[model samples]
Target: MPLPRPLAPTGRVAVVAPASAPLDPADAHAGLSVLRERGLRVETADPAGGPAAYLAGTDDARVAALNAALARDDLDALVCVRGGYGVLRILDRVDYAAARAHPKLVVGYSDVTALHLALWKEAGLPGVSGPMVASDWGVGLDAETEADFWRVVGGDAGYDVRGPGGEALTPLAPGEAEGVLLGGNLALVTALLGTPFLPDLTGAILFVEDVGEAPYRIDGMLARLRLAGVLGRLGGLVFGMFTGADVAPGRPTFSVDEVLAHYAPSVGGPVASGLVYGHVPRKSTLPVGVRARLTCGAEARLHVLDPVAA
Candidate 1:
């Protein structure tokens, strides 16, 4: 199946909340302002601001808002407001059929990883594993992250992403792997292992990252992937920024390096070193199911192999 094409900057963008509680109007406005400055027109549906506990709204309500947006011929794409716990609650409730038939650039990370995987599995349309409208852009994505977002959205043919200026990549395995890039939050990817939404990783470079998870927790999650045969199936692996800010006040019992080494061999493929994407500021954007080339040795590099939709 062909990947979903990205919308041009002037196209109308739909802001919705498949997850997260309610959004603060102030934050939403700030984010939309940034998009507007970039030449995009963003509009919100009624449920975009509605609240139902920790979700934007009720399962049915959220689904309705999303479906309504997807059904619109005028909306060029949908951008999630935030990624919280509730998206999984309404995972099955989305009308992916119409949306897939009329592919739109769906964006978000973290909880939104669920949506990304679903869209790829059910619709065969690739979506951005990037920032959400409310948090990423509003909270101030570092200059690098902001640039990476436009690069992916503009469908830059292929490009390389390096670690932040002085930051160094910690190599896990030495070599290179080329194939479609697939994966998001380590926790989310592991959570869906036995589920239907998990993508086929036969020859894909898997990338994962997360926020607030303890190193031990990261270890456990990677272990689950190994047990579920996820690691063993990848063509390669890319470890993203595991934000330590969310870890409790104590020293981590395990380091990310240890966790990567433990599972690197199980993947039966090359494992690229540290990648600066995920729960950190200035995160790099990646299309969940797009193809890419990952080289790891003395230095590390991720070269997108497939063209992002334009």
Candidate 2:
């Protein structure tokens, strides 16, 4: 894990729209208010980059905004406006040299997971797999979610993450382990499997989550990971809510739990599910590539060893 780059109060953080354009421009504007309320100077591109198809802008435009954000020394962090798709198209074009020279916090989840995998491999750069501006910030963040979001991204380190209601993590397989915390959206992770961007999770406490992916689709991706020897490299396995992945009543399909039964054991270490870490309204802020310890007990707890910012 890299050393922390803690963001001081009132530090500047740029907002970049690297994925799809915002569904609601109102949300983007409100999201800006949310950040300003945190006492930070916020900068953003014309997030209204006049949609070029489904993307916020043409491939080159999105890449330019992100790379430009990295090149600036004034910014303490970078946050994505939203995530839909299109990151892979610009992955190869993003030059991380400038980011590597002066590392700053990068934040997003879902499609941005691909960016996390790429940046972590290219520059050992760390990012927040947590709330996004339009995604959570504009979705009416609750007291607890807002508090947790600031604590994690505000440069606090070594805090424990647990399931909803502060419940113990329920293990599918029992044990304890510790390693760099890595992983994000399952679909994005699956898409990067054979690519150079995939981080080598040799001793990683790997975690994954997704939304609307059916049971068989999840199973197929997990199977691919197992065959690629991805699962065997994990120090532990953590699964967040598989929102909307459930099969409908009377449908002849395997349950999400059933899919896990086939692959969780391949992890060669502890495995826990129902972790509140993805695709939900109340999302946890995860610092990519940070050292963390996972203890699977009657309650499972993960403690991030490094702060997100310097």
Candidate 3:
């Protein structure tokens, strides 16, 4: 993974609704307040308004806001306020040249995965795809997740990521591997198939997480990756929190672990289980474009090899 440029205090950070719409005022207020309290300047393209069905506004409006922020001299970074849906609508609409020219941190996850891959593959900029302003920043973050966020953003070196000390942290393939970290929401990743946006995962550490999807859907998406020759190319794999996949009523099916074994034959890389990310209550912020080492031993640790830019 390439190192992210260091984020200094007083540096300006712009908030835009890249995926969903503008955030609810309450969520916005809390997130903005947190950013301000952390000693950074905060600006939003949405102001304090909500649009129809509430997406920062329209595709054009959201794109305009993001582009405007990119061009701004005061802003040092761009953070997505929330991620519900809508990024694909404006994928072609974004100005990659303008965004690359400015070169600032673009952060968010879920639907925002589309933007993360675009900014990296299209603009060649590294971005965080772990937490959203409305989700992680404003809300109270768990100690483990919070610590990991600052460690990465601050460019801390050689750290270990342990699972929530429980039986939940079981190995799938069991081994160690090093490669650039790449991946995000499972749905968004599969959706990018056959598009210019789907990144080349060759020799990359593919990390993925999702929320509220059935085990079969997760299996199907992984199957798609295998068919597309993605899984075969990865150097390593990490599975973040696969939340809300409880068995459906009257549906006797395989567990997430069972699904993992089903694809184990096709995956060539050393795979780890239970990463502390995804749509869970608290999660670490991850830079998708940075290279890192993933060790799956008694514990799972992702040691970032890229320096946080000085």
Candidate 4:
């Protein structure tokens, strides 16, 4: 595995919109300001054209901008502006050669998960599955979230995964396992099933999270993974926040917790929840493809075992 160079305090970062354009341009500007305030040089990659519907630009333009950023020798990192949609459409066209040749930290989540998985599969490059420029920084990150992001990308050796309030994770199954940390948004991970982009996650510590998915949908997705032999091959399993997945009042439905419990037995090893990651303001910056250890019992603990950056 190739770890990108750790970003320095004064490193240059390219901001690109590989998914959706910022709903408000002010958010983009504010996000850029945040980077500048951090004493980093920030540059925005302007695609050939303007937004095409919901996407930042046409597929060709978005891919071109992303490839250009990847090929840049000066940039220390590339951060997506936001994650709405469109990355899946241009996955095949991404310049994986550029990615391998110039491995740099790419940061984003949600729709960006597809890109992260594809890069890892095609280029053996690791990435920070953390906050987006416009989506998080523009809105302002909580202290913990901001600290976690910098700690990972800045080449911290390792750290314990803690909730926003510094609470320990809740244990779902009693055991321990260690492996490379993989996975991102639940929906995106599920969508990549059976695709060439989805990496072989055998013996890997998979962490997943999502927003707005109902309990039944969560159950179905888990079922699909179980049926596909995904859950059975895991070294361990961790669940982040499942936002907006609560059961409606007076409705017949299992809670997200119930759905997860139903599938806990399918995992090959330890199981845990409340990882303090996902589509939330206060989320951890996880380095995809890095080795990590998960311990679950009375107290759940996730310890990243490798520096994300060289």
Return the top candidate by lDDT.
4
Clashing residue pairs in candidate 2 (N, C-alpha, C atoms within 3 angstroms): 5-309, 5-310, 6-309, 6-310, 168-299, 169-300
TM-score between model 2 and native: 0.95
Judging by TM-score, tell me the better candidate of 2 and 3. Answer: 2
Worst 10 residues of 4 by lDDT: 156-165
Which regions of candidate 3 fall more than 4 Å away from where they truly are?
A: 1-4, 47-50, 163-170, 297-300
Q: What C-alpha lDDT values do all the predictions have? A: 0.77, 0.83, 0.75, 0.90
True-vs-predicted CA distance for residue 292, candidate 2, Å: 0.9
Model 4, 52-169: lDDT tens digits are 9999999999999999999988999999999999989999899999999999999999999999999999998999999888889998988878888888899886688887678688
For residues 1-310, could you state the per-residue lDDT of candidate 2 as single tens digits? 3443666547788889889988998998999998898787998864345778889998888998888888887888888999999899889888788878878888899999999889989988888888888988987787777777677777788778854356556778777888988999999999998788898988899889989999989998899899999899899988887888977789899888878867878998888887788888876777888888887767667778877666
Ranking by TM-score: 4, 2, 1, 3
For each of the candidates, the C-alpha root-mean-square deviation to the true structure, in angstroms, is 2.3, 1.8, 2.6, 1.1
Candidate 1 stretches greater than 4 Å from native: 1-3, 22-24, 46-49, 163-169, 245-252
Instruction: Write the residue-wise lDDT of candidate 1 on 1-310 in tens digits.
Output: 5455666778788888888743576777788788888788988864744687777887888888888887776766788888877777776777878777777778888888888887788777788888888787776677767777777876775777665453445667777889888888888888787777777878889888888887788888988888877787788898888886244566656576777788888887778666878877666788777778877787777788776575
Q: Estimate each model's TM-score.
A: 0.92, 0.95, 0.90, 0.97
lDDT of 3: 0.75
Tens-place lDDT per residue, model 3, 88-176, is 88888788877677677777889898888877788777777655678767775666666666556665555555543422334576667
Clashes per prediction?
1, 6, 7, 0
- Give the CA lDDT, 0 to 100, for residue 121 in model 4: 91
Select the stronger candidate by lDDT from 1 and 4: 4
